[model samples]
Target chain A: MLSEEDRRKGAELLLQAERERKPIPQLSKTFPDIEIEDAYRIQDYWAQARIAAGARVAGHKIGLTSRAMQLASKMTEPDYGRILDDAFYNDGARIPASRFIKPRLEVELAFIMGEDLAGPGVRIYDVLRATEFVVPALEVIDYRTEVPRAITDTIADNAAFGSIVVGGRPVRPFDVDLRWVGATLSQNGIIEETGVSAGIMGHPAAGIAWLVNKLHVVGTGLEKGQIVLAGSFTRPVDITAGDIIQVDYGPLGAIGVSFI
Target chain B: MALDWKTLEAFAEHLENAELERRAITKITDDCPDLSWEEAYAIQDCIRARKVARGVRITGLKMGLTSLAKMTQMGVEDPIHGFITDYGMVPDGGEIAMDALIHPKVEAEVGFVLKRPLSGPGVDIDMVLAATDRIVPAVEVIDSRYRDFRFDLKSVIADNTSAARYVVGSSTTPFAASDLHRLNVVLEKNGSVVAEGVGATVLGHPAASVAMLANMLGRKGEGWEVPAEALILTGGITEAVPVARGDWIDVRYKDFGSVSLHFV
Candidate 1:
């Protein structure tokens, strides 16, 4: 049970880590009593400080949405964090290497909300109805906290969200067969990962449905006009400043970006 | 003459009804030129309460006419503040139904969210910078409810400062990541650059508007310290651009991402 001050300090350390482009010791290591709830509050504090400084929540990102990721993280469900406006990018944008300590790229789909979505009994269909469109996205996963991370630590680190680059074709939720959408992630012209949308809890929207239901417990819900990253389908690929990344979403479209 | 509680409630209802009906009405100040800012704010508060009563959530806050050029243009010494509601947000990359709005215009803005509560008698830029969490690029789609968008400042305040649809960038950068005053924004309409301005145009720095808002809100109460996590739109960086049906508007802020909207 981390105290309020402890949580605030945790956020401050992360902010310092962000500013210095360095990693800090895991919060779980420094504050062993920190619970999942505490981790979220710490993340909240980190985000709110940014908001106070003037960042806006453009959307949310859910992590560990797959069984493999959950198993790897030793968690049963996914974790999430707000996707601040600065963390968003256009396809083909060149990202500087100095922006992160260590960054990995993951292939995912992004859901753009068309209507408000809330919980208690939210489901995939509800998500489908609420989603205006889905586009191919690449999540630049980085950590401000040091790894070998605990679930609490990952949660507090905003699910290791570094930045998100979205491109390719966008389609309405019902316009395509989402379950079978496919992609191949290439780094420097070499195929490093391939994935199917079904790999995300059998449906990409399912995790978003789960997310809204979770947010409901906290007296919040997914607002309209927000973007949601539905979680990675392919395994994360290591990235460096000079690396070029391409994710081909088949008929949906493709995204190309480079780190410099 | 002082407004009675019943009259203020009626005023809120009347303006809100105009909004709901997608109709424009005359500004109240045209009739009652002596409307106090307090009463104007009270009426604005009443409108928000009415919205809450209808299950609409207050999303954030907005400041209007913060730029010296705009203040001088409007003949005002201080900027105005208003509330934003959830229903007023436009989806990123989404199109607006043109008929749903009345003479909408676009204002490219710098939006802020704070890490800590800010209240003030003496809040300054450094204080604002210290408290801010991150900076997000936003475009406010304002549709004034007054006929022909003409109204005195007090009357406009009562109309919630033309609070309407808004779109924010899906990314944010820490305050230290960029120089605020030097930041530049270009407003593009259908691929044409229509306007441009620097961040300093917003009262020398957007943070100054935030500081003024905090100080203004503080003076009203013990301090309605703009709370942490409150998303505040600092104000227009460029002149608000007019839009019509089938028009697309996009604003790009230096070092920040772009937010675009289309009218359909």
Candidate 2:
């Protein structure tokens, strides 16, 4: 357990790094005693500070739900973050390249909920029942901390969510087999990666179900009309200025973003 | 025929999702040919409820098609109202993404910030000006979720009058010191003038639009009123100008300076 002072200091470090657009040393290196609970405390402090500064919480995001991601990160658990409204961009938006430390893109699906969901036993069916629709989205990941981060360090940094670009046609969860939904991500007209939604914990909604049950332990739940970016299905793709990213979701439509 | 609450909510979710995802769909009227104005408003109310439930703050209300010219252009005789949320506001000189809209157009108008609550079936321009704290130049970016921006009155109303984003100018002109009816507005795109009109183009006077909105809301019996400190956008004074990526829109108000935006 981290002391209250240490938790605040951890939050301040991450916040300062974000504001300055500079990466700092991992929190795990400085706070060797840091636990998952302490990491969440630090994230909560930083999120509250951002809200105080006039940013609204638009949604929540789940990360590292895939076995591949877990293996790559050397972590066995998923992490979550508060998605702020300022971090949302329209499709084909030219995002400023200077706003991130080391920005990368991940292809994912976003669930827009129609009803509030809470639970210790929330299941895939519950997520489907509560979901209004699923739309294609691009998660902009930025690291505010140095490389070689631990799970505790990543959670404290808001799961590395910099922003999200939402576009494409929305479909009801039952309208299509979400597990088979596939995406082809291209950069500058070159295909970089392709994957199916099943890579997200078997089914995309499964991650949302997991998040709801997890949040129940903290006395919070997913609100009605909130957007949830389920875990990314593909590996992170490096982005650079003047790069145009297009992710085709086949019949679900497509989403694009330009970094400038 | 009366529509059930559940059906109205379903339609609201459908339309709201289109707006949020920046995708276009066929107008609702095409599917429900006999939809009534009351039912349209009900669906709009459902949209407002969903947004509020999602933690979106209601910043104000907006009136669309208040001008006789706009009514004639759209072949509609009455105006429509829609709620504006915090997400709908864009900073001056901000960049609007083209991908977030199906087909977007810009309109020059005046925005009213009220100092007192105004509700009525008998509210007039005098009462509107008396309640107003400041009036600022504004440019509204209207993006219809309907395919090709073609929709009937009922369809457009339920779609929130095609409201997407708006920017309020920094300069606030007092109502008493300015002559709104005679004020000319020039809308320029990329340094070239596109459309120009006087404030009188908006229902004789811009304040008349707000007065009409209050009367309309009061008659609906929804308990909805223009609250104090609410920002009300009067209907467009000029015809809508189409915009695209890399376009810079500048609306110059006669006395209230100007508001500009970029589409990127």
Task: Assess every candidate by TM-score.
Answer: 0.50, 0.50
The per-model DockQ list reads 0.01, 0.01
Error of 2 at A27 (Å): 0.5
Worst 10 residues of 1 chain A by lDDT: A190-199
| Share of reference contacts kept by candidate 2 | 0.00
Task: Please report, in order, the local distance difference test score of every candidate based on alpha carbons.
Answer: 0.85, 0.85
> For model 2, what is the alpha-carbon lDDT of residue B249?
96
Q: What C-alpha root-mean-square deviation, in Å, does candidate 1 show against the real structure?
A: 24.5
TM-score, cand. 1? 0.50
B213: Cα error in model 1, Å: 72
The count of backbone overlaps in candidate 1 is 31
Q: Report lDDT (Cα) of residue A67, candidate 2.
A: 68
